[model samples]
Target: MRTVHPTVRLAVVELRETSGPAGDSVGASTSTRGVKSTQPSRPTQRPTATQSPMDQFMPKSMSVPKQGQIDSALAKMIAIDFQTFSIVEDRGFRNYSNSLNSMYTIPSRKTLSKSLIPQLYESTQASVRERVQKATAVCLTTDCWTSRVTTSYMSVTCHFIEDFSMSSCLLDCFEFSDIHTSENLAEELLRVAREWQVDGKVVCCVSDNAANITKAMNIFKWTHYPCLAHKINLIVRDALKGMKPTVDKVKAAVEYFHRSTVGAEKLKFTQRQMGKPELRHKQDCTTRWISTFYMWKWFLESKDAIISTLAIVNAPVDALTQEEWGVEERGVQSPGTF
Candidate 1:
């Protein structure tokens, strides 16, 4: 037998021929043959792990802070950041929170006002009680004030030594609707001290020199001291009566600058030209004697700018005479003025 080549024996051959019937009616045919192809089977594939459809959009529940921690932080935002309860209801703030986390929801304003705030207040009260109970001796400072709406309120604060470090805490601030008398004020103080468990441990009480407070302290029978700052204020007020004319001029100047926009701008411009800080005149508050000192001090510091501004603008108030300016300078320079 003739030996056929191995390559030729394995190779598959295909041939094709086309025959046309006639030019008007043509027909064609074709055929193909090939050996079957054998490709190595691919290794079997293991199944893949998959997340659920909801998992793609949902944040990890475990990653969110606990409800208690969120409430506490919200409480701090109200107390420390001075945010109002209605802040929780703001659309912009809610959108911002949603952008940060979809899993956690902000507490409603009603919930914050009714639940979280009160809860935080109770927790803080408990902490204050614990600290106050451990003190050997505590000094109390209390005061009463009336709001612009004529609402009366009282506040108490405690000071003590803890671990050789000075510590202080505000015990309470509550509305005192009753008449402010010695008996009523004493009762309020006693109530706060007893509630905090510091009644017997209080060494002294310090308060302003108002008549009602003074008499209340007397009735409380703890060693009572009038606030030294109040006494100094009294001294300063009495000492300034002799210099009314000079004080009046300075006060008028401050009032003029505060009321007139043109004068103020001119003053600032003059200060800049003089290479001085643009310090504005301070107005004195009748209740605060220190404000008077600040006013006098600022007046002297900006005397040159004030003179220039007054000359430029038709000042409504009388300008200070050179002699009066000298007196103001001397008074401010003297250690006793402040």
Candidate 2:
């Protein structure tokens, strides 16, 4: 009965059959140096727990214990964690109607600057701090417009890093600017970065093709990405100008049919034909472009109404209609542009 460590036995056995001069000397030394050796051995490697079969399954379907038993078990355990929120009131000569900010048209910036950001930052956890630290590399964006005060206001958008699974950047909301200048915007952005301890980390700046933002990016030596989506949308509208008459005609018909009693009646009949009472107004009619797309879907749902209105409305069945309307067509042309 040999009382050998598994690793030691494996090592000795591997060295034994090498059949080289080096192997012979190593085997001889290893064999002689049994339990009390003055030599270094390789570090032991532990079996990974994550490789276990149990880790592969989550007990998502496990049944809960009886409510009474659960209640009793919870009662047996004790816990203590408490948090408090505070409200600051004003003792002033202004209107004390509701809160400190309600009375004045221009609230005290000092109050928020002194109290809010630090409090907000302090309330967050270590993981949030790490995210904030890494997210110091910011991308800035700006758009200028006249406000109700008749003052030109430039809205600043900053992209910050997020504690995310797949997403690297999260778009932070605007910080208002009274003076829209490259120098001013850069100063403000740097202030925000310094506040978050990310001033030196700004790698990119993003904005529409505005001179002010472009100038700021140039001054700061930051890489710039002009809002490609906005540029594409501008190009799309320019292209749409060529088809405006067709678009206007379709829009006029669609709006008139949906907005009026006669049109609503036609839509009701169309939904009835499709057996979809739920799509009265297309529940997700949130975007104008999507609305344009859905009008055809709604019309397809009420193909009878379409025939009743326009006999020439049998637009060739697209691939979308094949799956949606169950109308498979030969030599189908898909509505790929939209």
Write model 2 residue lDDT over 35-108, tens digit each, in one string. Answer: 55546444333343333245334323323344334323222221112211111224442245234333223223
Query: Over all chains combined, what TM-score does candidate 1 have?
Result: 0.74
Candidate 1 residue-wise lDDT, 1-338, digit = tens: 12664222232334443334453212322234554334432333334444435544445553345766876887888888888889998999889877876656788888899988999889888887898899999999998888999999999999999989999999999999999988899999999999888999989999988888888877857998989888888888888898888899899999999999888988999999999999867999876888998899999999888888888897877888889888888888884754
Off by over 4 Å in 1: 1-54, 58-65, 148-150, 177-179, 259-266, 269-277, 308-316
Candidate 2 structure, TM-score to reference: 0.41
Candidate-wise lDDT, in order:
0.82, 0.48
Off by over 4 Å in 2: 1-122, 125-130, 134-191, 210-212, 257-262, 273-333
Q: Evaluate residue 110 in candidate 2 and report its C-alpha lDDT on the 0 to 100 scale.
A: 50
> Cα lDDT for residue 179, model 1?
94
Q: Pick the candidate with the highest TM-score.
A: 1
Candidate with maximal lDDT: 1
Give the lowest summed-lDDT range of ten residues in model 1.
23-32
Candidate 1: count of backbone clashes, pairs at least 3 residues apart or interchain: 0
